[model samples]
Target chain A: MSEEQNKQTLVAQETITAEVNSSDTIMDVFVRGARKGWKVAIDNIIPNVLMAYVCIKVLNVTGVLAWFGTAFAPVMAIWGLPGQAIMVILGALMSMGGAVGVAMSLFNDGTLNGTHISILMPAIYLLGSKIQYLGRLLGTAGVPGKHYPVLLGISFVNAAIAMFVMKIIAP
Target chain B: MEELKRKAVKVPISGYIALMIALVIFSGLMAKVGGGWTMLDFDTLNGKFGLMKSATASFMGQGGSGARDGFLFALSLAPGVMLALGLMEIVEHYGGLKAAQRLLTPILRPILGIPGICCVALVSSLQSTDAGAGMTKALRENKDITGNELLIFTAFQFTAGGIIGNYLASGSALFSYMTVPISVPLAVMLVMKLFGANMMRLYCKMFVQEEK
Candidate 1:
């Protein structure tokens, strides 16, 4: 009993020490976090969104976006999304922000709407950025190479399921 | 890795309060409230840009395309991203995440077939993909989890990896267009993540030959 009490006391002391060590005021902490947010916005969001717009422009100029909309229309109909929405899914595989960029571009051009955006939102993140994450996440975690396909498959399945759920829930 | 463990500090009551407030902010519930309460909402605080001569368009204007349009559009999104992350940071510093870790621990085994020890990595993964993956590697190297458990946890992190950060950051772009509240889709992502993890658990159980 005494040993347990001693351990508790040690833990209590450690907590107090941690509190003392973090001397920044609340406002300071908030600003520090906000700064990190600004960096992400500048570093990742802007460039990626810009790239997505350009890609969409190229696809638009080449008439590929129209072609894709016709080709994928049947498949995307399952999610109540237009055929061009496939581009958002494809973009998500590479980068989540980029997928958002595509979705935004499509929305701007009248190919999608508020409801379509709502449906695609969860699906975008559910399988978002898998190409980069295949190495950054799966490889780093040391999952056997053999199971990579299965992991990716599972994410795709999850994304598919999320779209169905979003379709039901989205207004 | 050890330092990440240090982050599992005792979550004070303030941490719980901070987390609740964070949820309320991101939940979009307060977005409709009148008066000063709007300050508590994300979109309300994000605010709108001053209109150009058209009155209908923001600074980006219309009939634009390609890189320049994308650049201006993305620039328009910058403030929302910054506000979201800044608030996320405040939540982290207040131990909201640690409190989340605490709340998530007990349900870990039931939900993901992983141990409570993984709660830290799970929460970390919700914020940053690299941090979660790095911690998972450490978890495996330390032999804190079995091979199958690692796969399941990785599967969870794999789908919807960095949920909060990615959603609040990039997903913020769609916030205005959504017919539902912001938190609804977030909830959907989280649910799908768990569902995906369980699928992995079943796969590991049925297919893989256990070495142990």
Candidate 2:
């Protein structure tokens, strides 16, 4: 009821309001971050897992991967990997998860060894997101049409170097 | 152009050194010196528990169901990847990335030959390649970074997209299967990716014409 008491009450209300606003901003940042994170994860994982499933089935049923492996065996030999690694490469071209799936199947069957998986892992990581990166991200990003080849070239070159390095040091 | 210009900042050399050191530590290259340090040692832990081994054995025993097993393996990595992406998004939201750009510009400018502003894209790419490329594309569209800068930065991302998160998930998976220390392979990958990026930067410098 006193003037001093009323003034104190007004000041306390303003302080609380300021504190709440600041905390809300921090909370908003975290909530927004979590939502975005989950969105990115789901977007990447679902397609990746699905594609891996399909690739594994196709590899299992068709045996085309084996044929391709035999065909690419010589080239793959240059990289110190077995013919079956073609499956991993093919899977990588589609998605990282697909590559992992293919690698796992090969590992289970005793077609690919630990060294081979080590050699392939980095290459897959480097080039695995190609579909999404090239088709959607780059296209929408307004990169010059001319630069696409250059970008692709970089990815392949990186993969190649990764393969070479991994082959030597994987053990 | 004004917006682009406004975003660019002169990063200090000390900041670059700090970043380089941080990167090395984060990549787990100095594991021996520190008696061992890594964000994920799932492989060793898995070995102790025999979790991954048993899982693989059971999956293999199913026979003709390789697809299902493979799908499950990939799905297993989802949690880590999603968490990484979410953390990155939060960092971006909080302007941590912008601050990093200011600090990392000088270093990136010299090594990758891109402007400092590209650090934002670089950091973004380290969380998710798509996010990085998308951000780079935005920078390019805004003329905040030049065409040459775009190419160089793209090369970097191409080699190591979502570096930390990607490696943590994929690398852990690899280690679980293989017998090597997880950090060794991860270090190898990071080095190779950086090598590829540097090679691309050199290529751009030697071949690509300046966009004056």
DockQ for every prediction shown: 0.43, 0.22
Best candidate (score: DockQ): 1
> Residue by residue across B1-212, what tens digits does model 2's lDDT show?
23333543434454445345444533445444433443322332233222446375433244544445655655555554444444444444444444566766689766777777666567656656655655666567667778787777776776556666667554445555664555565676667666766876787779989786
Cα-based lDDT at residue B18, candidate 2: 38
Which residue pairs clash in candidate 2? A37-B86, B126-B162
> What DockQ results for candidate 2?
0.22
lDDT of 1 at A153: 96
Model 1 per-residue lDDT tens digits across residues B122-150: 88788888778877777787788899998
lDDT of 2 by residue, A94-170 (tens): 76766776777678678888888888887787777677677655665566678777777777887888788777776
Q: What ranges in model 1 sit over 4 Å off?
A: A1-23, B1-9
Q: How many clashing pairs per prediction, in order?
A: 0, 2
Give candidate 2's iRMS in Å, 1 decimal. Answer: 10.1
- Tens digits of lDDT, candidate 1, A1-171: 356334433432332223423678877876776788788888999899999999999999999999999999999999999999999999999899999999999999899999999999998998899999999889878999998999999999989998999999987
Top-scoring candidate (lDDT): 1
